[model samples]
Target chain A: MKEKLTDSELIAMVNGGNQQAFSELMKRYRKMVARVVIGMLGDTPEADDVGQEVFVRFYQSISSFRGDSALGTYLTRIAINLSLNELNSRKRRFLFFSVKDDEQPLPDLADEANVDESLSRNELIEKALAHLDPKFRSVILLRLIEGYSTKETAEMLGVPLGTVLSRLTRAQDRLKEIVSKLSREMVINTADTTAKVKVKTELK
Target chain B: MKSKTFNPEKNIGNFFENYDADFKPFFETRVMARIENMVMSYQMNRDFAFRKIFMPALATLVVVFVLAVIMGQGISVQSLMGWTNIDMESAIASSMGY
Candidate 1:
């Protein structure tokens, strides 16, 4: 009967200092939170830390949680905000070290050294997404990875629907650009290596 | 169909084609461990606030009372606040057990 209790009931128990109730809430939303966190933070230890923080934050403030949205959406919102906060803090720390503070931070993805033919399609997309600006990346994460409807995505980000659409277009364009660029370079390198191998074979 | 060209970018979606991260075993247990740690830390903070902050504050209030009693000029907690003296004559007449 306790397992069958609804989200409201679970939250009430959590408010009463029930640790198991909190754990149940975590179990219910863990994967969705992980998907959003890991999609932003990558498959690193940082992602796991952020994922855990999201539930902890929700548990701490469970009393203020008036169920205006589905519990999943509420948790997802926290996950997204925390991920962006982590990013902004990283940028601030970088700014503190850099000499030219006047320059606007350009949106660049991660180190593409991980970009190679051996990577699977999923790994490639994940890697490519790392290069995208956080705004555009959120669009891809929410739209492509999490599969939220356009309206829902817009609501979550507090942006207009048109904004979400435009961001999606930009994100897809960037993704295509990065993927195509890497794919081309890899293809060319493979061709060049093959050509050298063939000439060596001829000499032999 | 005139043989569609192989554009690597076009097949980008195919990379995630049939791709999803499988659920790792004991994922819930791992998450719960983190939550439990957070809860314990929060409790410790509350405990610290009571011991480190509340106890000292209570001690200061007790010291204020002892200092006021030693001075004995009707040295109530209110006197330290620089409040205007109460009109005791008006107070006694108003409280005539009516």
Candidate 2:
């Protein structure tokens, strides 16, 4: 029965202190929130926490949710803001610790021979995304990945439309470079492994 | 040069359209749990604030009001500041030697 209710209806129920209604709303929008949060922060535990936080914040402010925009868009705006805050704190931690950028370990590359292909592809996507500045990443995720228009992206990020457009261009260029670099590295790693196998076979 | 063919714009769009980020099982349950915890803590904090800070503050204000009324001063800025006996016009005139 709750599934048939609209977002505004569920919001009204939630405002009336219906926790079940809020749960229904969460079930409705969890994927949208997950896309934004996971796109920005990658698929980490922190991303999960941030995803929960987006809905929690919405529930807290449900009374004031005037339905000025779509519920998905409002939750998305919160997700982006919280993700950016997480990124800022990550930057601060990196700076305070003076950690070398390269010293940051890759996601489980030690068993490259046994790694699954699709998993590696997703990892590659994430690594390339990590190279982008948060500003550019937000644009890429919103504009390209999540398929929001330039105007919507700008509004979500609280930037000018021109800024979103420019950032989208630069982010695409950077991602292309990073993806190409990663592909080359993958090819080289394969070649090195093949050469090692060949040398061992010949020696045997 | 191979990177030129790897258009991130088209590829990432296609990839992410099908990409379900590792959404954990029981996501709604976990989110609801967190919300419940948050609501619980918020109510606890509010109750604590009312008891610890607000109640004492209200009591002090009431005491001050009662004392003021008992002393025949009522409530005014001067009376609150214990400045009830000063005549400002004459005091200023005398200070200025008028």
Candidate 3:
């Protein structure tokens, strides 16, 4: 919305310590970064915190930004890296907490009310995303969801373009498999709704 | 195996598109605030660095001035430590190096 300035111009302004320019850069890419965070971590509150950390880190390092790729791509790469690290640490913490509190009940219904079937779809995709290794997940999110070109994805992730393509292929396959499994489960659950309704009506 | 009824790639893309409509508006604000905070913090740290260096230097200069006045003028250590301004000529003459 800020007239889509070239990355070089934005980089120049940021290096000159222009706070508003940095803010403008953020305004352009925050949604994309949040989506990447959510995609990597699934819609958890931690995503918001890590998403903020991502941009902060990007701002801190904007001076080092060379215009090898688009600014969004560069920032996305940083966001992905930080988000993955946060996700790893969170997973470790959860394991530790779980071990300490073996009897704690994990909540089952996270999103029960206002059941946008789309919400479930998002959750299913998120679950599948959680299954992939972080490296593959980064590529998949950048290319598929964020619509980065293969060359751009490779540069952003600091890998070869072929690696991006390969990982993208594998990630797509794994994601499809996960989504299919989830779809089947959703179908089975929906299929039993009539019987559940009849039982509830009978009890009433 | 279960019958392959769907293309997973297409499904994945479809899943993204399905929820894409729900993207909230404050996304840009969130990112901008993060960037601003980061730059602001870095600026604060640099300012702090300057202060940290400057304050100690200023303090050292003040200390050297106080010490030079106390010792260079042959003032008694006791009176200098006590913050008492003794007679400089008597103090120097008594020491026999005036």
TM-score, every prediction = 0.67, 0.72, 0.64
Give the best candidate by lDDT.
2
Q: Chain B, TM-score, each prediction?
A: 0.55, 0.65, 0.36
- Residue-level lDDT of model 2, residues A74-187, one tens digit each, is 998999999999877877778867554322433344556534333366566676777677788889888877788999998888899999989887777767666665666666
**Winner by TM-score between candidate 2 and candidate 1:** 2
Query: For this target, which candidate reaches the highest TM-score against the unseen true structure?
Result: 2
The CA lDDT at A114 in model 2 is 36
The total number of steric clashes, by the backbone 3 Å criterion, in model 3 comes to 0
DockQ of each: 0.22, 0.26, 0.20
| Candidate with better TM-score, 2 vs 3 | 2
Report the poorest 10 consecutive residues by lDDT, candidate 3 chain A. A100-109
Candidate 1 C-alpha lDDT tens digits along A1-204: 354889999999888878788778777788788778877766777677778778778877889999999899899899999988887876788876864422223323243443243545555555666778888888888887777899999999989999999999877877777766655555555566678789999999
Model 1 TM-score (2 dp): 0.67
Residues A115-189, candidate 3: write the lDDT tens digits. 223325557666667667777788878887888889888877889988898888887777777666666655555
Model 2, runs deviating above 4 Å: A96-121, A184-204, B1-12, B49-98
Backbone clash count, each prediction separately: 1, 0, 0
